[model samples]
Target: MSDADLPFTAALYASTRTEELAPLPWPEEAKRMFLAQQHAAQHAHYQQHYRGMEAWIVEHGGAAIGRLYLHDMPGEIRIVDISLIPEARGQGIGAALLHDLFAQARLRERRVTIHVEKNNPARTLYARLGFTILDDDRGAYDLWEWRAAA
Candidate 1:
């Protein structure tokens, strides 16, 4: 994503983060502030840990709806993150994107991996897409992997 996309991307991140934080009973305004801070920190963490990441802005009907960050290394294509706005979610957009990624990985003969929170609803989708747990011992996030049949 370009610098011009930062605000929109961050807003998308905040929306997804808001859903994850919904169970916490925090005041709306306070949650807003917390989400902003958390977004900045998470962005920084991604920058530091995954250099050369590719950030893509997900769009549909000529409007921005989400962000997908990938760390494409030699043997694996890691889904650094992927999220869609609440309204845009559960509409098969995410599954379509994953199918595209899987096709690309299949051609490249590379595996795909992602770390997702245990309770994230998207984990069900990932499982349905044939992503198996690689490491569930992770505190909150379990590492999942998928590869084409040999």
Candidate 2:
């Protein structure tokens, strides 16, 4: 995403963050403050750590719905992050994006990898899409990988 896209992309990020915070018992204002701070920190972390990260603002029918961050290297395409607003959830968007990523991986002959929290519902989708756990030693998150059949 470009500098100009930051404002809208951040809004998209905030929507996803709101969903994440939904289960907490905190007040609305507290959630708002926490999300704002967390977004800034996460953005900075991505910028500083992944110099060549490819960030995309996922859009549907002219409206921004989510964000995708990827890090492409020699033999792997790492999905640093992918998040959608609550309204966009369960709408097949994430699966479509994964299929597109898989196509890219097939063309490039590289494996696709992503880290998903162990209890995250999306882990089921990843598994259904043929991503197998590569590592689960990192506590909450498991590293998953998918490669085309030879």
TM-scores for every candidate against the unseen true structure: 0.94, 0.90
For each candidate, what is the lDDT? Answer: 0.91, 0.88
Model 2 per-residue lDDT tens digits across residues 30-142? 88787777777888999998889999989999888888999998799999999887889998999999999999999999999998888788888999999999999989899
Model 2 TM-score (2 dp): 0.90
Assess candidate 1 and give its TM-score to the true structure: 0.94
Best by TM-score: 1
User: Model 1, residue 63: displacement in angstroms?
Assistant: 0.4
